[model samples]
Target: MFSRLFDALQGGSGVGAAVRRRQVDAEVPNFAEADDVRAAFFSSALQHAKSSYDAERDGYVWGRTLRPSYALQLHPLNTVQTYTQKKEFVWVGLTAGPWFVGVVVLQFNYFAAFSVSLYNVESEESWRATSRVPLPGPWLGGQWVPNEKGEFGPTSAGHRVEFSAPLSTHRARLCFAGRSVQVDATGVVAQQLPNGKSAGAQRYEVHAVATLPEEFLGVVFPLGPRRAALVSKVAAAPLQSPLKLRLGGTEWSGDGYLSMDYTRGLLRRETRWHWASATAPAGYGFHLSEGAYDVDNKSVENTFYAGGRAVLLETRVEFHKVTAAAKVWTLTGDGIQLRFRHADAHDAALHVGVVKTDLYHAWGTFDGSIRVEGAMYKFDRVAGVLEDHYALW
Candidate 1:
């Protein structure tokens, strides 16, 4: 049977050199101070963050599944993570079939070293913050350099700082909340600010963007024990969310201009993970990836994008979790033979960093579900629909 489905997708011999020879160093937990939770999910064009990525405590499981054409990450600590000033935002979407409202504004020209956070999930109020002090840099007292590698604000007669009004074109819309919401993109730059107060559930007045995020939200990691080093049992633990994905089949768009190698800091960028599936005749097949933790090459860059082709999977493949369940809530991985169901839900949670998780929930997939995390069950059917190649650096 195709070599027993290639020995259960290479548990056989050649699909990641014997599962990277049994990975089990498991040691990247030392988080405290309430886990230093500082969330981020500003892909703006009219808000979208109710669980762009969450870290549910209880053992461990960090999430990130943004789709503008790829950005899936699954990590389980062992030390060695790096996502150095690696910005990947480039929005301008306005779809219909999949519902993507619009409203993009760009001009965050460095205010300080860096900190407009929300590149994680599990909201906690205090949204849209930018520092470094210097104000009006695209005009009135504009200042702050570098544009291609971070640092914004700077236009001084260079003219260029327009996100227009008119209720910001229907006040843009594309929300997806998760807690003490705030959605950041930097104080509108010319107007809009002063709306924080509420805590935990308030998603309105949307419209906010500055693009550059999708390379799996740059760099994310969450393994076990509520990470950050035990997370002090994460407020009494209960976390265990690792599998469950609906995965909107395929929709496309690209506006290019993302390349680099940083001499080797590695951004040897390519940017183009376009999709086109739309399947769900009970369909289920997935092996996605994204990476940014070469921690001096300890290994794990399983970066690959199918259909649009971008295979890189083989950073020593070895992300074994095997069970991951969630009844009626609809989530079954490995044992249940991979399956996910949910396509338009909001109110998300799951933060293992700076911890602000309230369990978790995020859906927006037209079908074709299957999110595996520590899966393995073979008896009768022996799990069909197989075709694997997963690597998430």
Candidate 2:
């Protein structure tokens, strides 16, 4: 199937074929005049066409397609420094009925990592495994944006971890300490039409393809004059196919939400951030963060997904300090207030020569509400995860 898609992208004249497009001029739009949060945020004149990659301007886009309309090439502003600072990763987090599942494949120019974690919500039984191996060369790891059909992984040989994200399905397999974890998640695409034409083509033609699952956030922020990073996030609806999570010889399955993180490009040497993701049944979810990417008039990533549609929450978030004895952490911002109760955590501290990392992925329940456009959406004790991350590479 992928072979045919690749062949079509290579020469086919269909919608899958890559088209040559120009970048949008970097002009800030009047977000105040926009109708909805999604429209206001996406109204930024700094947009990127599906087939465009601009080193001078940063932008974001989202689509209902399982993969991107065009393959993202490795284009570095500081070409000579690409080998040292470039990074790529594909992370998927799911909330099955009584389980929390995660699969991540990450590759820095220096090393690559594959991690799989599973938590039984009711039993409080948790297991996680992380494998980090030094990269022999810059091009040694797997590709995040391989072809038109799209595939991402840190498929370093002998790692015992495998993951694939294609147009139709997402599957992952991991083995550690003689125990194993597997995930199979699938979702139905919301077919959209504009003027009786395929939304993909129409969006490509107008450079408006960066829209959503109905909601998404993508941005390219400058790390330095010569360095920048592209971070795209999506908090999507529950999958059509029941989420299947297998761990310790038992299988757990149910409808759940999915959130993805796709980050690439040169980033800061030292970075820290407080991130949170939570989802309620019936397609209510949000992705919020407070560091790494600056929140200003033109750049922000905080978003709410209501009814499978993305709405912008362009306010700075404050993450309260988390201590060993901390049970509930408060997160607040304009029109947003939530509490995250700690359940269990996967913590790790890695100090390899000059590279250092202190990471914590905590899973629990989120109880609170957020006000959007004068309407309050509230949830109680919905499954969620909070992350405290500091890295130097």
Candidate 3:
């Protein structure tokens, strides 16, 4: 199989060659206290005051409570104890009303990618499709395991995608050929904080969410040393309910909101990133990402969702373009400021030799505003999506 995947990539030992291997003096782990990792998922109880993966009492926990098992032996690639790379992916975005949808499913065990997109805010028109397969293909199945219980379904090209949550009824489906999208939500519950105060379910206290739990930015750091660990979970919410879209063939259903991205460790072998997702319908929204699994800024997956409550932006959101044919892009930090006017885009690329991508999916309109805490949220033009990625996995 491609010479044992190029002898596990020129024999440097997995996790993308341990991200340029060079650190091993031990002593790492002890940086999770930014208010207990932002109240560690503010509690409804998926429980994790420490449950697994501990280089020593865990490193990050904004909540999903660790508990992922990795075992790839053959130590000494410079010790992180045989750090194997296990990355999983799930990205979903929908803004129902006038229609805006996106779905992504990726599994890099050998190769996998699927994408479906549509946008139409009173007739601006857009449709996109993508599919790449090559890893014991069955579409995709299992292993984002934290609190457990998840499902994925896929057969082959003429695509159909499915995601199930099993407990609080989180379902998603996207069909091909004729185009389709259906989403049913009821996952996070417990809300009431426009100062009316109700948000209770134990711990971390109030900042509500009614149709969902919109606040999941789980973290676990260390990429060049300290056991090389890296875990992630990102969420953007407003899938408040009622969303059904079928373009060109006309179907359209109401309401919108959903943005999810999840991850698993040992990455960085030429990974680039700049992501943005917007949501609205009174529940406001934002989810901005910064390059390759945190470069030095420790923890930052930048989030700010209100009305559905989930605010954590310790500053660090910057993506400007003076080149790459700038179509007008600027994302600032610290109390935030935004401006993205690209209007229609969905380009995907794959070089296939060692796996390469040029992924771009710009679909714009986000006029600016975000101040959290001191309260000041706004985004005049709204309607979002901006992902400019480059990967060599």
Candidate 4:
């Protein structure tokens, strides 16, 4: 059944040709136009848009014309009519005391992958594990249910996500092999901006810091058609949360930094990006990304959040690896500079004929400064992750 499904999705002719055609049709909007469009489109929608699900569109539709928010809203669109173009996931990162734990649950049409990692901040000792479940059905795998307000959130059984009134507390759990990992958090909205407004949908961005409980256990864990030609739109926020973690009979607790990434889209066959986020001080957050998937360099994702405000920067970031081993590297960008020396790293290469992924993830620190709002915020050492990823599916 899996083989046949793969053949059905991958066997068609002119897939590459179709992708090229779409690339031309979907030229990214110019950076100069992005700000004006976002302000005009999102401000109106946020004020007057009524949120309602469009079964025909397979996601929430907002505003007078009933614009689809699949591209912008922080909700899941699992019921998209184009089954092959749908991909969705929720990623959470927790850093507290001497430990950092990362958890994720991802669903592509052909399979679902769950991963958990525990890292020690001081020593850089890390343990990571992953499990893959082949999914060969029209329903795909898990569920992503929206709130009463039609906002994108997660809820699942066995492994579940929940929320409290006014969307204050966001909670999640993953259970496998009689062990569990859980997150109990509360988010404070910092800044909200327009992500982009397109003919198909209107999108916006939000920055927040989610506060988490000191400690919890269980473990669990994209774009384009052609099985790889889609783009996964993302809304990510750096977090100010506390954490208490228990894994493999060991426990640790401390004030931590967390980040949430909510994504939905179809991805292209080949993709690359640079991503890093950190809790530089007790209440300040730093995040930066440069990726092929972004509409352009002006993506709101490239900014810093401090004191509940965001400072958008004009950044040109480059990564220079100092060694062939790729364990030590320097990342530099306009108004930003950092060095990452991987204490421990994870490398995975998976290929199944037409599908391929090569991913390297390193947890490290940034020793530099970021200029925000014409002011420089310096850091001798700050905790974060550096990732080099490539995928063709």
Q: With candidate 3 superimposed using the best TM-score fit, by how many Å does residue 11's alpha carbon deviate from the native?
A: 9.6
Clash pairs for candidate 2: 61-210, 62-210, 215-310
RMSD in angstroms between candidate 1 and the native structure over all alpha carbons: 22.8
Name the TM-score of candidate 3: 0.29
- TM-score for each model: 0.21, 0.68, 0.29, 0.62
Candidate 4's TM-score reads 0.62
- On TM-score, the candidate that comes out on top is 2
Model 4 Cα displacement at 242 (Å)?
4.4
After best superposition, candidate 2 residue 311: deviation in angstroms?
Answer: 0.9
lDDT of 2: 0.53
Instruction: Encode model 4's per-residue lDDT on 1-393: one tens digit a residue.
Output: 453343224321111222232221122323223565334323444223222222333332322111122212322222232243445566666656666656555656565555555556676455554555565342333333333333332211132332222221222342211112245432221111123221221111112234321211100101111121211111122344445554434444556455545454344445676666665645455556666434345333455655544444556667788889887888787777778777555567878877788888776666878777777777666666777877775
Q: After aligning candidate 2 to the native by TM-score, how far in Å is the CA of 62 from where it should be?
A: 15
Question: Best by lDDT, which number?
Answer: 2
Clashes of each: 50, 3, 2, 31
Rank the candidate models, highest TM-score first: 2, 4, 3, 1
Error of 1 at 352 (Å): 41
lDDT digits (tens) for residues 300-362 of candidate 3: 567776654566677778889745775679899887889887756666787878778798878
Which segments of candidate 3 are over 4 A away from where they belong? 1-4, 7-85, 96-104, 108-220, 223-264, 267-278, 281-284, 287-302, 305-373, 376-393
Instruction: Count backbone clashes in candidate 3.
Output: 2
**lDDT (tens digit, per residue) of candidate 1 on 60-112:** 22322222221111122111221211121212211121222212232222111
